[model samples]
Target chain A: MSSVAIDLAAVNKSYRGKVVVNGVTFTVAAGECFGLLGPNGAGKSTIVRMILGMVPPDAGKITVLGKQVPAHARLARAGVGVVPQFDNLENEFTVRENLLVFGRYFSMSAREIEAVIPSLLEFARLGSKADARVAELSGGMKRRLVLARALINDPQLLVMDEPTTGLDPHARHLIWERLRSLLARGKTILLTTHFMEEAERLCDRLCVLEEGRKIAEGEPHTLINEQIGCDVMEIYGGNPHESIELIRPYAQRIEQSGETIFCYAPDLDQVRKQLRGRAGLRLLERPANLEDVFLRLTGREIEI
Target chain B: MMRMTYGAAMPANARNWLAVWRRNYLAWRKVALASLLGNLADPMTNLLGLGFGLGLIVGRVNGTSYIDFLVGGMVATSAMTSASFETIYATFARMHTQRTWEAMLCTQLTLGDILLGEVAWAASKALLAGTGITIVAAGLGYAAWPSMLYALPAIALTGFVFASLAMVIVSLAPSYDYFVFYQTLVLTPMVFLCGAVFPITQLPAAFQLVAALLPLEHSIELIRPAMLGRPVGSVGTHIGALCIYAVVPFLLSVALLLRRLMR
Candidate 1:
């Protein structure tokens, strides 16, 4: 078995007598990208804060990078880097100044910091804007700088909370590409995002959080396979009752949306064969995705 | 490019404090030199306006020129103003708008480290500003070299005390508007009535007792006597009062901030 970088046992957290994280437990193995998938107010950030020892868990224990949390928290955090959801860069500093200043926290000498900064900037694809003030950067540029700042200490574990939040598609793809590079270089990453596509594309393993509890855990494809069927046929612009009756026999699961009906079947070809005789039905067949797994798990559409 | 604790064995608190100072130094060096230079404009205005303007009216008090009399008080006032604003207003913006402290806490830094770092940095800025004011005061023949040496520690003490008090304000403050209440109601009253612009003896007895309890009053009292060539009355008592003023609020603010952050 691979060594665990983050280990939690029956962790519980509460705010003002209301329990948020209720007896949650999980482990993230070394060199793996573990994604926490949740909707808003799902207590994802709270759990991440506890793991980083920013807040102490009310009950149970957590360990990161082989050190017990909230006790040896400093030691644990020494090897950890974080990219918060908000862009929290110092506006007065240039991009290079921001990186140089953060390097000082880890006691990196000036020459050493100078040497690593170019590579770090290149890693974030922000090499050209190094001398520009952080205030002058775009939202995407700021996000990339935050990521580059997180890398200054050469952390063993990187925790990113909604790292691609509020970014354009191009920026999101760029961040994902950089993250993939980091993973390939054997960096352990813990990420939280509301973007199912992001989780599908990046996570080696993932867990869905609902109201502070782990509702589902597995690989993205495996999750869809177990919770939702392999194939789903979305039938819109047809009579709902007639469509359900017609497609129900061919599907493992049938769901409806206003005027449309969705049928999930193991074999799309067989389902299509059964629907061949039905007229006035516009049918579209596609493979199940993380959205399907998410809806199956929560019975609600995923949003920020 | 990373080193562990700078090759010295240190306690956990010490190590974390160093990290906090490291982060603060990084942050301060990014902005403060310019900030200090900007703040020098305030005392220069005071020297130019208050010293020359008011000097024409009052002429002298306690055998010293009005320009000389006002320079000591202005230095203390600037120190208080800089330290208080640095932590209260600017710190509030960082806490709420920027969320910098929230991110910093996610690292190895503790609440104590943050508190110390901010206070120390503000104190350092106050010292630099105070030094500039002193130089300007000396050039105007308002201060001598002895008072300059005394002013260094005085400015630092004044800044430390106000920075701690402002941190307490930061702990309870939720918005930028709240800082206005602090400045208008609390800081304004103290600056006006706390013997900075004038001696506390000129105030009524009830106001005198109130001023005695204030940190700003104590700061002005501690620094003013030395500048005026007075005996400075029991150095131990002055040190004790200033330390208490700085320490009590510092400990309280740290406790409150730690609870807010860690909980």
Candidate 2:
């Protein structure tokens, strides 16, 4: 109990009777980087809002940092930092002013805010752009400023919803590196992301959510090994109707796309042998990943 | 030295409320400037065009110059219009297009903080614009020096009342065009009929009853007597009415903002 940072028990939330979240129960261990992986409309934002005390759950208790949410949300929030999905930087102020103004809310003295400003700028590599207007900064720079602003109060728990949602690869990697440093310093983090690779890269343990319910929960490699087979072979086109007919004999599990076929089997060599005899067919084998786990557990296609 | 990561750091959430205010202030500052400038333009035109142009013909009211009648009206007009603009237009944008209030709610800030900060700032802007018009009025010798002191605070409170009222409108408003309906159907007619431009005695009986229900009628009536240095009575009644105007909408706006934000 002492090591638990966030505890959600029997939590349910409904929007105009839609029941967006139903009986979600989980505990985020202190110093653990936990990830919630799901598609859009999977109630990730709903749960995040509930934990932040933005909305009261219909029936349940949410405790953050050992205090009940919203009721004690002010105190709980004092120790928690959040980076939202869309960057909400104030366009009227300079990048530094945005940070300074936010830091003021935590009741930090001017000296203390100033003392941390330099280090924070250096941490996010935004030292030179402090005086730049928020409107003038590039998308990546604004993102970094927001991250730095979130760290101003030096929170014990950090919650970020899709932090790298629309960023390019380089910008995303920069955020990843900064987050890893935060983890090394023992800051507990609750993260939600649609990126499989980000979950695989950053999270210590993750829950896969589909339609507002947790379908699978485990470490990345463990989930891939247990739920998904070691290898997958994607077969494309000999004929539209007869495509599954050809691979069905060898494949233990066969799933069809519009014109392509996916054959999941324990023995890749046997599947390859059958595919070799047939001409005008394409075959590629790769290791299984979170996308495959999502497919196996949620029974949904990997649109990406 | 053993470096502490966050050694009993000042809790960020305490400041969360202020951050929400800062966000709104920064978002609306540009619009506030434009609105203030636009409002100042009206009085400046009065100072240049009406006070001078029509001053030669109409002369003065109660031995005071024509510029005098225009000055008090312009000061009251600026305060009313600026406060109304802040609430109606900018509040709508924050609620709808900017999605600013929604973004702020995701933080530790409560809806009450946002409302207080916004109302305070909007009132401040209206007072400042009122001051500018007053300065011009003083220079023209229409506004008395002592009256400026009392009238400034009065207009500030008046602006706050309207700003809060606009917030309520934004909360209930469904579309941008709804503002036009509000300004045209509700605000424009109210301002004209409220004795801002003419005396309430000149208005018909039905129009006078309608104007009495609106806050601006009381606001202009309260300031007009003071600007004219007339002995006004029942000061308590005016203050009470204005207080109800400001407080009711303010509370409603906070509640509505909280509801929308929580969603």
Candidate 3:
């Protein structure tokens, strides 16, 4: 009954001499919803694989559910559930049969699995399609079924890797609501995603990773406020150096890239007054969010 | 912070492997009738075509009807074909196309559990195919009913050997087309050269030596004697060779698949 559900100490991994996860250390407490946010190739999936014992780390230690990883991964995994990034549902089986067969994988008897199938189908909003073949179900339905399948064993620790990556807004919201209910029931969740909004909505505490290194770790609001300030002002079509000099006196920080310059400040009015009526200059002001903090820390350059 | 300990570390066990087997069974049950018919058709056609067509001219080669001699070979080939198809095509579909193996890995099932379960399922399919042909052979009056009962374990062992060998091939295969190489280079050649259709004595001295080393030849050797109620020659050596075929490839398959799937 360790307070921490997952602990990674100085974990490192590489593929053919290219380091993917470098010197990463983090702990997820029991019943906490922790998020790992990063761009593609930032090693989010690699970390998830290491936790699942699918891959061994080249260096350092990992422990899940109080058991040392790899050595005790099976024991730990028995109490854990995972929803992988890809749709791995059995296309050959019907919706209910998919759950039924997956339940057996967790060692649940037919009687137990049958008993829960109805309720789990209802939970996934797929009660109407219980007998529908997986190929017949829509993409949203498939994702929901995958989510329901992960709960077959009522796992204590739920690991979801980019659970809402390819879904529509409607589907994403439904999944988020279901996840919230799971959290209320006191299940620890370790999630990874590229969507900053999803992390902000679901994660209790999150870490931002860039190129296999941790850039920032804290509560969402704290990271936003501490790193990027209260508000962000985007100024377009202004001379970069002049705008920087003009905004520098009033701004806490200024980030200039291409045609746009971002001004982070305690108050937007002071910076706004200086740029007011300036020829060909347009200003858009909004409250800072996790995306701002993410961009500021990880940079605006697209990671190839 | 309170710390808890797991009661025991569960290694790869029979229960987990059985679960994998059950999953495949449940899925296959949807098309069970069609699948059985598909499995039975090939062997029956061979029995009828070769038994009647070739038997007319050749008559008897070993003091028995050509149909009776070919029955034992048909049983061995059916087992090998069924097991090979299951492990290569069906298992590959689960691993690469359907991602069923990846799904199983997320649960309590280990890679070892998945591989063992796959082999067991393939062997079961082989048993079904071989047993069906054996029954048909009995109906055609080519096999003694009492002696045919003893062929069950031999057929099962044949299935396991071919299934394990197919698994080893699958672990290295890059695409579906890669299977053609195995089918051509290994399976087809063995089907003809392993005394499945004709006696090994009719071959050249070198080929006869080659046939003696093959698993299918060992399987047919054991099966032919048992089905005919004749005293099995060199029983120990044939059984020993079959055991080696079943076991060595199985271990190799496990090692290779573990490396491929477990990274």
Return the top candidate by TM-score. 3
lDDT of each: 0.80, 0.76, 0.87
Indicate which candidate wins on lDDT. 3
- What is each candidate's DockQ, to 2 decimals? 0.36, 0.25, 0.47
| Candidate 1: residue B234 lDDT (0-100) | 66
- Candidate 3's residue-wise lDDT over A168-282, tens digit each? 9999999999999999999999999988889999999998888888888999989988887678898998577888888899998777666788889888899989887788898
Model 2 vs. true fold: TM: 0.90
Q: Which residue runs does candidate 2 get wrong by more than 4 Å? A: A240-252, A302-304, B1-36, B46-63
Least lDDT summed over 10 consecutive residues: which range in candidate 1 chain B?
B1-10
Ranking by DockQ: 3, 1, 2
Model 1 lDDT tens row, B162-189? 8888999898876667788888898889
Clashing pairs in 1: none
Question: Tens digit of lDDT per residue, candidate 2, span A1-304?
Answer: 4699999887887777687877778889999999989899888888898788777788888899998875667678878888888877777678778777777666676788899999999998989988888889888888888888889989989999998988999999999999999999999999999899999999999988777777878889999888775689888758745756655776667766566666788888887776676768888888877877887776676453
Which pairs of residues collide in model 2?
A: A105-B15, A106-B15
Per-residue error (Å), model 1, residue A113: 1.8
Clashing pairs in 3: A1-B3, A1-B4
TM-score of each: 0.90, 0.90, 0.94
Looking at model 3, residue A304 earns an lDDT score of 28
Q: A94, model 3: CA deviation in Å?
A: 1.5
